[model samples]
Target: MFNSLISYLDSIRERDPAPRSRWEILLYPGVWALFFHRIAHWLFGGRLFFLARLVNHMSRWITAIDIHPGATIGRNFFLDHGFTVIGETAHIGDNVTIYQCVTLGGTNPTNGVAGKRHPTLEDNVIIGSGAQIIGPITVGERARVGANAVVTDDVPEGATMIGLKARSTLVPAETWLREFIPYGTPCDEPCEPNSGDRAESLERQIAELRAEVEALKAERRGDQPHKMSGTNC
Candidate 1:
């Protein structure tokens, strides 16, 4: 446990592997989040509801993140950057990577009743920046949520989700890592051609057809001689 803490600290440090001054690095963002979350989760589970709420509020104040105390997060859960929001009922598995502006929230409109209303992200899942996995959905193990995606339904194991309303682009683990690890390459797979592209292609085809029509009209004009209005011989 100590080693894990140390490693976690190191990851948040400048040199990563090398540890900096204990005093300075102690308040690293990730470490602070982990510590706060650990305490908050513990208090939440122990039936200290008010205290848990307080801790969660404090965490939000300090970290700019709103993680519900009731949310169950497993070990080595890394919230990399930006404002991450986890709903009160979110269930995050071990080794989950949540990036900036990612939200694991519920979509249920009813306020009173509650039972598993939030998303359950399975182990080894990596959610990219600005991804929103909303409602009581099970994002399967090893699933990858692409940047800026809005997912409402359940994602299968090892699936990669992208686009608005979220469509799955299934691929092998090795391929996914190779394409997505470094980031900034659009989506991982060859997504269906965008409407804009299709529209542009159609426009080009229309232009070509119009040019052909004009040429045909010119050829027909050239093929016929204009009748002389009053000429005879």
Candidate 2:
């Protein structure tokens, strides 16, 4: 457990670039949240509900992040810029990447006794900043949820979801990282320009080209009659 904590600290230090000092790095709320999560989760599973709730409340007070003790979180689950909210029945799998302001919430209107009200996030899912994944839907493994996306349905494995209603802008894992990953100083290359807007621009150019070609053809046809009359003389 001590070794795991050390490794987790190392990971946080390595991943975060804006850490001003060693003390700042050590004082990250995310690390503390992870520690509290583990303890709360253990108490929850052990049926020590009162203590688990106390730990959960304390963690939330300190981190401004709320993770229900009933929620199942897997290994190496990093919450970047943590202050995110998770639902009681939410099930998160291993290596899940969750950014700030992401919510795994329930859609059930009653808010009664919690029994699978929240969503299930499968392994290796990357949820972008401020994304809202609500209801009892399952986000499949390796799926990518774009920033500020509002997803209310089940996302397929390896699919990339974007926009308000969360449409699939599917891309392979390698292609996604190369083409859509946002710019960063540590990143090797710039993201490919968005194809959707580029396609619209191309279509507008094509329309203009077609109109120009038609005008040229008409001008040639008009001149041909005059040329024919002069030749007939």
Report the poorest 10 consecutive residues by lDDT, candidate 2: 180-189
- Tell me the deviation in Å of residue 61 in model 2: 1.3
lDDT, each prediction: 0.76, 0.79
TM-scores of the models, in the order given: 0.65, 0.66
Model 1 is weakest, by summed lDDT over 10 consecutive residues, at: 179-188
| Highest-lDDT candidate | 2
lDDT by residue (128-193, candidate 1, tens digit) is: 999988877899999999999988788999999999864444444454443222122222245454
Tell me model 2's lDDT, rounded to 2 decimals: 0.79
Q: Residue 227 in model 1: shift from native, Å?
A: 23
State the lDDT at 223 in candidate 2.
97
RMSD per candidate (Å) reads 12.7, 12.6
lDDT of 2 by residue, 94-190 (tens): 8788889898877543434546768899998999999988878899999999999988779999999999753334444465443222111111122
What's the C-alpha lDDT at position 214 in model 1?
A: 100
Estimate the TM-score for candidate 2.
0.66
